[model samples]
Target: MPTTATPYLLRSNTGKNSLKGALDSLIASHINQLGPSMLVQVEAVTASAASLTGKVTVRPMVQQQDALSRPLPHDIIHNVPYLRIQGGSSALIIDPKPGDIGFIIISGRDHTHAVTTRKPAPPASFRQFSMQDCVYVGGFLNNGPDQFIQATDHGWRIVTPGSVTIEASHIEANCDITTSGDVRAGGISLKQHVHGGVQTGAGASAPPQ
Candidate 1:
């Protein structure tokens, strides 16, 4: 009878002697966690007796997500597991891997974290806000915790865990402004500037009524 496959045996078969050895080595170099086990087959050929063959099935381990719902250990998702990247130069489901960079935005709690070769994972906390490049606002409003905001020279952003009111000029590209209360903005920017709060034409905008 043939011996059952074991974790150690699985590793040895796929590591020491097999084509999967090279693949495993490659994966190890790139990812944080090593995948699960795989099957191994050994065959012996002889004229007097039938060939001796052993079969072992190995399965890859599942990876966990981080606080942002992104890969905990961090890795490029191909076409496996719950998340995967489809064929193409675009970042369909997950973010692009190496050589590609961009911004990541999660709407609210429903929004998910995605992996990108260029940008970091998006925020996941309730009322949490984030921007890739910049943010700008042009209006008046109030803000509080459960509410956060960020603006850069690139563009304007608004994140509200609660609510807020503000006014400004030149909203940036990647902006993160949130409020659980109420938010009112005049001009917002996101890139090199993070400007928020009440602003008037003179620099002191009237506070919320």
Candidate 2:
């Protein structure tokens, strides 16, 4: 078994490391036990519901290892810590750490915000922030209906309804299901009931350990 190391803190917008490296670190630092374990989830970029988008799918560079290595089921997942895509012909590369946890990519349409999930949740943390936002620091097991991450008119927000069960949930952060994107639970079971949303199978949803 590999020892779980403390993750390196990420600066907001330094742009030093590629998004891929941040993701790899997230996986390596999480699970230390043997056998199977869920590492991280990634949200990929796609078209919107109202947009009339029609295009041919381009095969990713599977042969190329110099840029980004193909994500594997054994590799731990980590969202790109800091790297923004702007305009045309903009490119960046990231390398992930090696592990058994799977990886997922998340991209936003209008604007993207990476919520820090690696930090420890403060005592009595509760409130709603905005919609379509991402949380990546840690998971909170909230049992209270009023104390959960919620969606508002402006954006998706967090409402800590009550004391949430942090460990029972997957991912470093818990999202408030603000938008219509695919959240690959990897077939994760919830100790609590989800309010509502459509679950899709983009990756392998293995049985939880």
TM-score against native, each model: 0.14, 0.13
Q: How would you encode candidate 1's per-residue C-alpha lDDT over 1-209 as one tens digit per residue?
A: 99876655366567556757877777776554322222111111111111221111111123467678785532332221121234454332321122222222213321234322224566444433222111111111223234345677986565676645435685575867554643334543233334457555667644433
lDDT of each: 0.34, 0.34
How many clashes does each candidate structure show, in the order listed? Answer: 89, 33
Residue 91 accuracy (lDDT) in model 1:
32
Model 2 / residue 99 / CA error / Å: 15
Error of 2 at 97 (Å): 18
Least accurate 10 contiguous residues by lDDT in model 1: 39-48
Q: Which residue runs of candidate 2 sit more than 4 Å off their true CA positions? A: 1-72, 77-79, 82-103, 106-146, 149-209
